[model samples]
Target: GVVGGRSVGVPGTVRMLELAHKQHGKLPWATLFQPAITLAEGGFKISARLNTLVAADPHLKKDPVAAAYFYKADGDARDVGVNLRNPELAAVLRRIAAEGSKALHEGEIAQAIVDKVQKHPTNPGKLSLADLADYQPKKREALCHDYQVATKDFRVCGFPPPSSGAIAIGQILGILKNTDAAAKPLQDGIPSADWLHLYTEAARLAFADRAQYVADPDFVQPPAGSWSSLLAPAYLADRAKLIGAQSMKVAQPGNPGAVKTSYAPMPDQPEYGTSHISIVDAFGNAVAMTTTIEDQFGARQMVTTSAARSGGFLLNNELTDFSFAPADAQGQPIANRVQPGKRPRSSMAPTLVFDKATGELLMSGGSPGGAAIIHYTAKTLYGVLNWGLMPQQAINLPNFGSMNGPTLLEEKRFPPATVEALRARGAEVREMNMTSGLQAITLGNAHGKKLWMGGADPRREGVVMGD
Candidate 1:
């Protein structure tokens, strides 16, 4: 499923960070990279998770460079606590710091990316130098929705398409709120069966709409009217009415507007891999960024500079996110089909919350879970806003949600009675590992003083630090 150039799309990370830094950075450009450079040169210990992942990946060993970097002389993965150095990476960072974004976007570095992508031994790609040179980062308006829980209300904002995050989360939460789901309390400090039932059903409905309507906004238009129409109160109420005490098992897409759309629903495809960052500056301006290169280690092609001194970054296989068949069996074109200059559909959900009445910033959060990103973000937001759990406590909760399929519960986390109860109500319960990496920061008052609370997912090697 992961390989050469066709899988590759123009890598936007360098451009994305460059734009963000230009807008909000207060420190000098070079100073911001000191920590990373230092770590790369000085070496850092490999975490258990990284070691396990390296041993598990079947393809990483295929790349000679990756194999050399990640494995030991005996051909086993480098063990946990081993100090791994990356002089190559350190060299690249220095160039990027000195020349800014141009170092990677143009000239020598860009050419190497094109070569690695197109010249892969077994799986060649279509990316070219022109594509790399033409890449442009876009800045769009963040999508915000007003959410009410009992007497408290808040405004939640998330990235808009080519991300299906905000729309899906907004749709699910909106539909749930239309019913009595929000009013139901957590039983024994866990989401009650009633709440989970509604939440999972809403997830199926939202994912149904997601598969049918969401795509790169530059290429695809929303169904009835604007994108906001999908989350409209009346529309969500109509959609929520379909949830009738039992799991629908699988859901069909809804018509969110009056106008007829032209695209077919994209078929189920495996979507995975991402990293999230949530930061709040002294000025109180916050950022939630969800970055990825499609699957782990991107297209599995790492490129070095012309001189081969600096180690390179992974290229993204983002194009694979598009519907491969392009059309359904009935001949209707899929909305998320690949096209030149079109970005792929994504599930990265970077979020910001605000007090609706006073417009004060409340929280920032995001996660990496492929299509389940919607459920993870919704779970965290609901935990913080509705249950008043601290960010770490919310993130530590078990992960559960569906992508319009079987109702999945995190393996071994719930009581046996909980699984049987769902099955009795028509849900096909699947228990397996649902590793969700979530990061969050929230603001609240304690002991008559305002405090900043931060949380990181225990599933990965992430830590929250504040001064």
Candidate 2:
């Protein structure tokens, strides 16, 4: 159901990048696109990861264009290190570089997208050309919260809603702050069972709140009249009180002071696939960007500029991010339910950390793991800020989180004793592959000089590079 034209949303990457470049860009727009154009034209060798994904994807072969591009004449995935070229994408990129976002949003490219979505033989979509032409990227205020570790004070900033990332993370950290979690540090460079128990309990509470109140800010009002109310100390203190030595086993959402809402909590659903980038430039500018197409190979529908369809980009199934069941049995609508012109709620947690005392940019970090992104990012932040581990060390630590249900730990990473200890405390512990693609860069002092320390998650394909 997720892998056809019916799932595609109006593409917005070009428009969003253009908006960002209009404000802070120093280089020429065309010059900025030259590298991508070169790569598309000249091609790059396929990696083991790409080969595996292509081999495993069941829906990709259903699309003629995608099948031809990613597979061989015999229907086998291209071997690793095989050069793959996309001249059609190069042509599209060239037009975009020269003509700006208009090339994609107004003319031939936009028409192609509309035609593909509305005319799909099996499952068609309703995306219109007007939707593409009228699309506008938003610039929202970053959600920033004060965090103190030992004597060091810092400000953690994350993307505001239509992303539940920052609020959920803030709630998790805020709830933990009211508990004895900080007093129990890592044991032997790994999180102790004591610490994990508290952390997962906190995560459960945070996710409950997320399901209840977090959504596109334009469509839903924050609880208690302000987003900060969810993270208020008094509210968190009361929430933390629910965390006993034993797991709460599916925690419920807390009332943040006096709040009134008619919306129902969104039921849990599967979420998957995203990419993360953390970059610090020589000019002291930094960015933490998390981009996604909802599922692997997006809608499994490729949009090419030509009838030949030699090369193209995949369309996003972002509409699926909305709640499948729009309302509860009692008829109360869910906050994240799909609506006309509404942006879907996302778990993309692009984050930045600043030194409170000096106002210096301390870190740019984020991850890609669907709903688990909040936990992955929170883990890294806690590791660096609270536990005093390096960014790489934090990323290297085993991924664990509770999305208000079972406690998930990366398979084979935790000790057997740790697993048994969690089970003994009434937690439904499950060991699975928690592949987190996290990238981070933190400010550091090296030999009395300022340096930027960067880390890339070994769980996925990522690298740290600077000149």
Q: Going through the candidates in order, what is the number of backbone clashes in each?
A: 4, 0
lDDT of 1 by residue, 240-353 (tens): 999988899999999877645588889888888888889998888888989888788777777776354224566788888888888999999999998889999999999999
Which 10 successive residues of model 1 have the least lDDT summed?
Answer: 305-314
Q: How close is candidate 2 to the true structure, as a TM-score?
A: 0.98
Candidate 1 lDDT: 0.86
* lDDT tens digits by residue: candidate 2, 251-344: 8888885556668889999888899999888888888999999887888888897778756988899988899989999999999998888999
Q: Candidate 2: what lDDT?
A: 0.90
TM-score: which candidate is best?
Answer: 2
Off by over 4 Å in 1: 306-311
Q: For each candidate, what TM-score against the reference?
A: 0.97, 0.98
